[model samples]
Target chain A: MTDRSDHSRATWRQSLQGWLWVAPALLFLVIFVYGPALTNIRFSLFSFSAMSLDWDFVGLNNYLRLWSDPKFTTALTNNAVYAVISVTCQVGIALVLAAVLEARIFPDFSANLFRTALFLPSILPVVVVGLVWQLLLTPTTGLIDQILWETGLASWSRAWLGEPDTAIFAVIFVSQWQWTGYIMALFMVAIRAVPRDLYEAMEIDGASGVQQFWHITVPGVRETILIVTIITILGSLKVFDIVWVMTAGGPNHSSEVLGTMMYRAAFRDDMIGYSSTIATVIFFIALTIGLVQIKLQKDR
Target chain B: MATARSFPALAVLNRVILWAVFLTLAVICVYPMIWLFLNAFKTTNDMFAATWGLPKIWHWENFSTAWNYGISRYLLNSLVVTTATVVVELSLATMAAYALVVLNFRAKAAIYTLILGGAILPPEVSLIPLFRVMAETGLYNTYFALILPNVAFGLPFTTFLIRAYMTGIPGELREAALMDGAGEARIFREVYLPLCRPILASAGLISAMRVWNEFIFALTFVESESVKTVTIGVMSFAVALRADWGVLMAGLALSILPILATFLVMQRQFVGGLTSGAVK
Candidate 1:
């Protein structure tokens, strides 16, 4: 490699030129991701709102005051529920679906069609997903309740997205429906990557199908599972669009996650300082969990 | 005795039940659009009477109203910002990915960790600071506010994807290219970049959708009516018509049309993009 490099002025030039090419993106991140993150920490220390230019230096008060706010407490609980429940249902369903699809029971073409069909919902715009679900779940005229009534199961019907008890769960269900297939596809690919020989050998040894899955498939995709776990944790924590659109964390903030709470505080309430504080807490939660996860994985 | 004979029959019944369950979900997933498409044509009266059943008359004009009223210049705003973002994001991501994979920087490991860390930093945290910067730089309420931030947020994902694909590339290619006196730029152009077209295609598709559909930042950062992107445009329409069912649905459909169309047509790219390095 060095010998080739010595004679090749072009290679050296390309190496230098490549940095120049990518410099803009790096600069963009420096200003946007890194720079803004620092600014967020700075904002947490200062009293600032979008409405006024005069911000006082109030060190740690914002973070300290968050502990006293009932709204933050409720929001923290809601975010916890949202993250845990959504990720479990979504990833668990994904694993089952991936297992089912990997069996290759259907004709190849039909199987691909089914896979594609299942994957379609994930790519649809979140606004559309929320609206479509809202309409479908509308209590009075909604097709879901209407269908339940028509089918003689009126007792089973309820205002799925409108009721306080059910709205968060409804949103979570919608998220699960959309995201499960996507993660399933990931599991499918990971499953497919495991050498067929391993599975065949397990079968040859008279291991049950379930046994093969436990012994061969799960181990093969442990890293991918961790990846999905982190993705789901981070994504679920930041999930605002669906919650914001569907219920606006409503039926009276019953579904209010941190994201919605932050949005309302900053934009709706004009309390930018409070919102940045919430944003700080959120950042710490995401960052700490992510670091802990990476540490665990590394230790493993 | 009867139960013992039923095992084979039950096995067949179980498979059938599984298939039935699968198709049931498929129906649930696809049924929303059937209702949406029909409702798009229905009067609000029809919508209230029943969520299902056919419209008395097709109201294709809702599309026009949404376009003319809700989208209009907002559509142009979306196109401009998304195009600029995808173009810039991909070009930069590709170059950076090449460096991360091919070059051995002194802090290469740390750089990689930084990139991964950047991926988890939610964009909302930056909203106020970004707004302040945009205001200070005098780019607030302009397309630049949305475009520049979108690109930055998009970079980590695209870079993650391109790097995944780059790992599969053989070191010998670089060596051979170097032996032939081709510079790294020439090799990236002649060898790596073209080989990465499929991955790039997916990255571009994902970035476009994200930029187009992004709402929170666009809502906050872009305030001018002329500069508003479609998501916030539709959102504002919904807010104004909070009690008006027909107009809200109309706005929703209108906002979704571009993304829906792009996703439907280039769905393969979306799927490819999701799997690229997203699930790792």
Candidate 2:
């Protein structure tokens, strides 16, 4: 009985030590992340401003306001468009590019060089990317316009970022430019993991290259494709720096997204509670995608 | 493969087409940055006059002009914030991860799942309330305003990666340490940490990159010029220098240079850290 009590004491000490080790991280996360997350949800059900401390309860009025708010609608629609385009370019095109690169048709040196060059922009500060593209897409004296004129396609040269019709697309195009290579790199890694023996077997059967790609590579990397798709979609939803820096959701809010709208509401317009409402929506969407991603990872 | 065996000429043509496509895409990917670098040296007149040619005179002063305009201060701010965030976040994460992976406890899985849940909540989701919290706590407009939230948000991913890494370490090392009468702290510091070096590097590099490039927090929390990071600093600088393309491009180049240089030097670790989660 005495020995058993001593062993239980030791076990208790070990558990205490374990908690001690995790205390600092838990403290910070609780205070900053989880705490604010819960507060954000509570803040959403009221009308408050950063200018005042009072939070008058409004009972989901902010969310209802979102439905009538044309800017919110525009931002939501623009984000959806961004999502679709990003998936198409970042995932679809990037997959094709990755497959071609991994086909081993080129010399290793050149392929490595290509991979590095393509992946370079993905690591850049988005602010820098946005600013650089803003300069490039400048109307009259910009390189893009200059190139169009020099190539005798001057008629196609207009204000790429100045018009409402083109502003969102221009911003999305720059995003693709920065991200496509990164996604391609991810796909390349996945493609490399596919067994080589399958390809050899298909070759002996006289299957065309496209057929082999469809039959072997696609099946092999399907999990990665799903993961990449979810990540790309999440990224699209979270996009802010590009839109904010490039146009600030401009040409009359044509390029507005949920992120910029949230910023405007809280900081610019001083509607803290309303911004919290938007934040809550972003939270739910991200949480749902994140849950799905976790589930997929588990299944894999 | 069959095409190469059955149709030699067609194979050659296919190879040529692929090469052309790859080269063009690669050029498209890299040329803009090259152009930006080249254009930074040109006068505004030269820049507008000939978009494709070399600068008549390499105006090195543009870089100095940008450096003095606020890029220097912003660089210092970013360096301090990134270093502090990485050091603190990694320390906390490594310790927590060690405990989670190595320690025996009843609530371990519950705690691990709770921490991992933070990864799903994007920083934007907590921006409003966090702003209020920062203001009320007097952290707004201070370096902690940036560093604290960053450390908090980064803990989840860093812990996840390090925990995963720590689990792969051989348990025999810990057993040997225990046999030698080493305390848990000593075993963690002397045994597991050294084994965790590669993963620490990977996690540290990734966190550094994220903190360095972070914008929304910088934009919202710190309004003073003294505390502004490069991302926000560059934005305001761009606005102030909108008409001066030469100096603007120079500032832009300077803003991207540090992270880009690090990425080039540690390409493997960067790529590994980024894709490691997905593969697992």
Candidate 3:
């Protein structure tokens, strides 16, 4: 009887071992991620301050205010411009470079070196990239302006970051510079993963480089392209550090994206309840775009 | 000229346009860093006077000065954070992945799908709430605050990736071990860990890069200089010394050097680690 009971004990432990396998990770996600998201939604509905545990429900007041907030409108428009311009350049250039790298069309070592150099900017901290660009594009004392003046184009010197007209574009360009490499690497990896036999079949059909790329390479990595697009769009929407670091949403709050605006509202304005509203807006916007991308990909 | 004759010229013009576009992009990509590189070697006056021109004298001393400027301490801090987090995360992820994949359990699909969907949520969405939570829990402004969240958020995704990769492994190895009367935990420790090394290495390195260069959390979570990562250190340097582009660029270069070194020395391993299970 004792031996049989020990055998049952062993079986129980084995069953637990199965549960234990995924227990820690799932627990962490559930507690930190899922729990926080639920709490976020809850807080978004209430009038809770950061220091207060109990608050009255504000209902849809936060959302209603967002409809009339000019700051929110500017942030949304700037985000749109940033997203459109950055995503277009980021994806388009990444594909071209990846194709060139895959074709081995450039001189030996040159292409790989360029690929590595391009990849370097992506890994650098956004804060540092922001600072570098801030200095490079500064108005009176900036290197770019100084260089233009020296090259006999003194009239071209402009305060790139200080002008409201050019400030958002500057931030977008900084973001674009940093991300293109990452997207390029993503494209390269996707290109690399395309099975060799598919390329061989295309070559047999007398397909040119451009034709084979359009038909075989693109089709093979359709999922990858979808994933990249979705991730890029989400990343652009939540862009905070580089803009905050470079421009501080400056030149009369011209460069403020949704993320930075939300941060300032919570931390600086000390409006916790209102910031929760902003945060919810950011979340919904990101989620909507993300879901739409996934659905679009599914339709394809 | 005949229209047909112009068609050949048009095709030639198109080829020239394509090459021009490609080369123009290459220049745009390389020239910023080239500008930074040249600017790093000039005096303060030279940088101001000849911002776009060659440095009168190579002030390589700026690199030395930047090196002396607590980039060392910040670099050390960044490495410590990354290494500790990677070790903790990989070990936890490995144990979790093994159990999730190989073991039989109830609620498996529901639990797994719930965790998988959490992967889609943007992390910053919960920042305000998390900050309040962290403060109430007495972990605010501490390394524990940063480390805990990093591990917590990173675990699900890493575990999911590892479990999927592990599923492609043959089941016979574990079965053979079981037949030999080896206990489950022992089989996991000795057999499973060794087999998971390649993917573990990859996952660990990727997490390390993320934590090492992570700015928003580091900025929000740790305010004091002592607890700050190299990322914050670089940001502070720029703020404190705005006009010193030479030192600032040198500092930026210094900050990224460790991560760059890790990539260069173990590039194959890093690449393998980066790309594994990611495409799927």
Candidate with maximal DockQ: 2
Candidate 2 has a TM-score of 0.94
Native-to-model Cα distance after best TM-score fit, residue A160 in candidate 2, in Å: 2.0
Better of 1 and 2 by lDDT: 2
Query: Per-residue lDDT tens digits of candidate 3, residues B146-243?
Result: 78778776776787777777876677898999999998789888888888877887788778877887877777777777777888888777777667
Ranking by DockQ: 2, 3, 1
DockQ of candidate model 3: 0.40
Q: Candidate 2, residues A115-206: lDDT per residue as tens digits?
A: 88888888998999999988888888887898898899999998988898999999999999999998888888898899999998998998
How well does candidate 1 match the true structure in TM-score terms? 0.91
Candidate 3 is graded, for docking, as: acceptable
Span of ten consecutive residues with least summed lDDT in model 3 chain B: B1-10
lDDT of 3 by residue, A242-292 (tens): 888888898899888888888887888877878888878877786788568
Give the TM-score of candidate 1 (chain A): 0.90
TM-score winner between 1 and 3, please give it: 1
For residues B1-280, what per-residue lDDT tens digits would candidate 2 score against the true structure? 3466667898999989989988988998888998999999988999988878989999999999999999999999999999999999999999999888777654666788888888777888888888888888899999999999999999998998898888787777888889999999999899988888988988988798889989989998998889999999999999999889999999999888887787789776677666565554
Residue pairs in collision within model 1? A10-B183, A11-B183, A11-B184, A14-B185
Q: What DockQ results do all the predictions give, each relative to the true complex?
A: 0.40, 0.56, 0.40
